[model samples]
Target: MESPLEPLLDGRTKGFPAAAGLLRLGQVGSMGWNVLAEDLPLPLAVLKETALRHNSAWMRAFQDLTGVALAPHGKTSMSPQLFRRQLDDGAWGITVATVQQLRVCRAYGVTRVLMANQLVGRQAITYVLDELARNPTFVFYALADSVAAVDALAAAAAVRRPGRSLDLLVECGVNGGRAGCRSLAAALAVARRIKAAEPYLRLAGVEGYEGSVPGPTPDQQERRIAEFVGFVGEVAECCADEGLFGADPVILSAGGSAYFDMVTSLPRQLGPRATQVVIRSGCYLTHDSDAYARAAVRMRERTPAIASLGEGLRDALEVWSYVQSTPEAGLAILTMGKRDVSHDLHLPYARVALRPGRDARPRQLPPDCEVTALNDQHAYLRTTEGADLAVGDMIGCAISHPCTTFDKWRFLPIVDDDYDVVDAVATYF
Candidate 1:
């Protein structure tokens, strides 16, 4: 069978370069100009259909293999369309990192949530309590580390004790990372504080993040991640020993995209406990060609059952830019700037140079075409070979990390196999 993409071009140009020709004709006693559509908003990105489905299936399969319910972090891709697909795939819930993110998820019909971060401030507390009241069955779990955080949640919910109670998880931390109780003793102390202030807040489970911890080597990294997961298990047992949670299930949630393999195996260390393990990996959605690509390879070697997640998750996001100038013989200036794709992790990868309005497939550029530098609105690309790309040629760049790229566009158009726009996805932040 022929791939849908081939015929959709329909003799049209396979790749876009510079505008080919312009025609002027007079009709109905009027003179008008016809020019090829060469220019588009530069550095545009898209989510490829192939990669999207691959990531979705990979995460679900990972959950099935590990026996851990997936509550994939929603902060990675704020697209509600992605969230709906996850729910359909048997995800227990979606995990978010902020009050605003929860609002966006709730608005989009995500029934269960894990704030995954500390829910602070009266405004944030009020928003969470109100969400619980509005949707009685809607479950939300926030991180509680310090007494201040637990107190604020309890104080806010105290007003509506007759309504829903705030579900919470004690966040475990190692010395230098972000928010979490450093010691198991400290976590228990915080849980005690929450119990002391009942009816307002309830200790539901234990959660931690492994993304922040650094590993000296692959072996060292694995050891640290395993220890972190083990600590989360200990907290779960503590809650069980103390008989804190009544009818509700105790959550032993922790795992980011990079170290989920280590976290999911935590149950082996806990031994015969009935606690539910929830892996909150979000970046599995739009796996990058750079940072996440390397991590996925490692995960494949370690966990074979869910190895499909690492299979051909294309760098679907592309930045389309025009060559503005050829400077100093070896350099070309692009119309895209820093206001476009993220440069914090790394620069964008140049995929192809589309000729203007012409229909021939794009020939691969020489190895010298490098994304050398970026400014506010222009990207400096250095090239030594490949058909002297003149001014006005379109270049499609593959991105690295997707979290930063998503916020650049308010609305993203989804194209089908034929490259024809099919649907539009909106983002909250």
Candidate 2:
């Protein structure tokens, strides 16, 4: 069968240099184009190949140590190529936030999908049922935090009557979080409703997102996360005892990029119930320089196992842009801005600078230099006095949130340590 990714190999991809002229994505490696050498367009987003491999392996090792399965959230980098990498690296399944993302995974031949969010809406529900009926080998799971959601899904499943029941994980959420049931009692009620739906719907397990569980302090936050995980575990146990669980090994999933160690405690709480603890960490694949890096430090402090896993996750993604203008002292306008990188949690930071002909090699930008603000196509870079920055100097920036950044670009080149393009991945959104 022809690979689904073959279409993305076109030379017309956003970041591909026009001079390369209709080259295959795999052939980019042999073309000898280097980022620092100015072989491609500036304001380009690229992934460090070595760091990508390391992060994947590190997460795999973490899963092995914790005895849990990973269903890496696909919403972070809606790129099918990255999905292939995660699947090849031993991801149990690709977790998406929408039915459109599920379609992308299905188009690329992903056999298993976990829609981390609730599968609502008639169109979305019908699409899922169609897929389940078409592909016998396919496995899918979605979240449900309310009786209405369970009933909605059950209604769609009953109408289609696919070969098997639609699997659903009851979502247990925090008071002010995004989705899921706000209380344990609410979560159990939803799970029981799912069981009542019978042959149309199956209670797979309980799941939640701990990243939104707020804590006034770090200690309080950890305590709240523990409490939230415990709440989810309780829901699962109650459903199991009531014979509400439809799957043999009930799944207890929750874990964003941060606080996965605490989420791993689900298995311990289940206590003899056949369960599969799955962590849906999306950003761990291309861990950012800002938010997730700080989270990693806290994770190591709480879980000694991470520190012992050789070197930790490095920032694999970087956006390189030229210094469009150095109009005044201590100020440089970069070609990259909100359109190219991320600024949701923290603004992109200047990491390295390279002058095309004047510099011998790329040098680390001064610690005092920072991205003060961003415009649609320009960034306000505040440099320390005598920072040696000049017009035309390429500035490589490290983003804060990989999810937002990955969505901005349709394609990101995978580069080696020397900044040579090795491979490229295409994003759907």
Candidate 3:
């Protein structure tokens, strides 16, 4: 049977025979090809295949250099396809923020998971126990902050099969961040409680987040992060001294995208027999040319090891909005709004402008062309020199924060080197 695109190659459509033939041969789908090169109004988010592959390899190399395993947080893309790629690249496991995210990873056949956050509440504890019982080989780790949290897991684990312990990590918290044991005494107390509830829960090791530690300078940030990494090392030593891990390998997980170098230096404090040091940096998968690019630059100045990460991770994510109204002499209102690209971190980068079927070319707007504000369906762009911009012209905006940008879209397309769509990647979140 002939496919729908086969008709385009039968000399029916003029001037699109090559596209039609490629589509019929299953080299490219009709929808993807048409949307990418033809400038169709598809309302889609496109991921460049070459960039995606580059980012993956770059992360793996970073992990190799740092001596810390990369278990990229799965909450960013939430795409099973991306998760499968990370797993194939020898990722220890995937990290998620919540139990619902665990279900998402599970649906993708991901067995090993690190619930980076805590598993609080009765239902969440039950979910964790059920996940453990169902997948016997599945290793799950969650942050334990208090006695109540440890007791809840202990009670839940008791109801499950005997001899099975819920692998748990004590989260060390700074005064500002979300969940974690505040001090060494507090952390040791939490670990003691877990050990007291023994046979049901095992104190894996220590886990902490350095990303949330804010500072006025890079040195300050690094110092603060190193302090947490030091805390992780101290806990690792304490756990081993207390013989908490027993036969199983003790796990020490830390590092978010900003400052993994500090966490890489943690083994010195953890001593031998620490076994595993997992770094759960999520945004490394889709490194943004804006936020992370500057971050990488700053990190290079301080560390220099992270500067040689990789190439081809361009800001491929863009919001293709049409010029809806050319109100003033130099002002153009776009069809995109706050709902498109994220405005929390930084503003978007203007990539290029396009007209229907015309090759996309970089157009320099006035030095003052800035997106001042965005409504739900319109973007107010201010321009200098009163330059004229016609309505219906499409404006491509390069995004800053990929994490927030990804959550805004469910289905995103995958494009080739020449901005031609090869496939489409979709996210559950």
Among the numbered candidates, top TM-score falls to 2
TM-score ranking, high to low = 2, 3, 1
Evaluated against the true structure, the overall lDDT of model 1 is 0.72
**RMSD values, in order shown:** 8.2, 1.7, 5.7
Model 2 residue 28 distance off true place after TM-score fit, in angstroms: 2.1
- Residue range 251-320, candidate 1, lDDT tens digits: 8888887878778765532333366788888877777878878887787777776654455344556667
Worst 10 residues of 2 by lDDT: 1-10
Pairs clashing in candidate 3? Answer: none
Model 1's TM-score against the true structure: 0.86
Q: Order of candidates by lDDT, top first?
A: 2, 3, 1
Q: Give lDDT tens digits, candidate 3, residues 384-406.
A: 66444678666767777888878
TM-score for each predicted model, relative to the true structure:
0.86, 0.96, 0.88
The segments of candidate 2 whose C-alpha lies over 4 angstroms from its true place after superposition are 1-3, 8-12, 268-272
Stretches off by above 4 angstroms in model 3 are 1-32, 36-42, 268-272, 308-313, 360-368, 384-388
lDDT of 2 by residue, 361-394 (tens): 7899889999999999999999987578888999
Per-candidate Cα lDDT values, in order, are 0.72, 0.88, 0.73
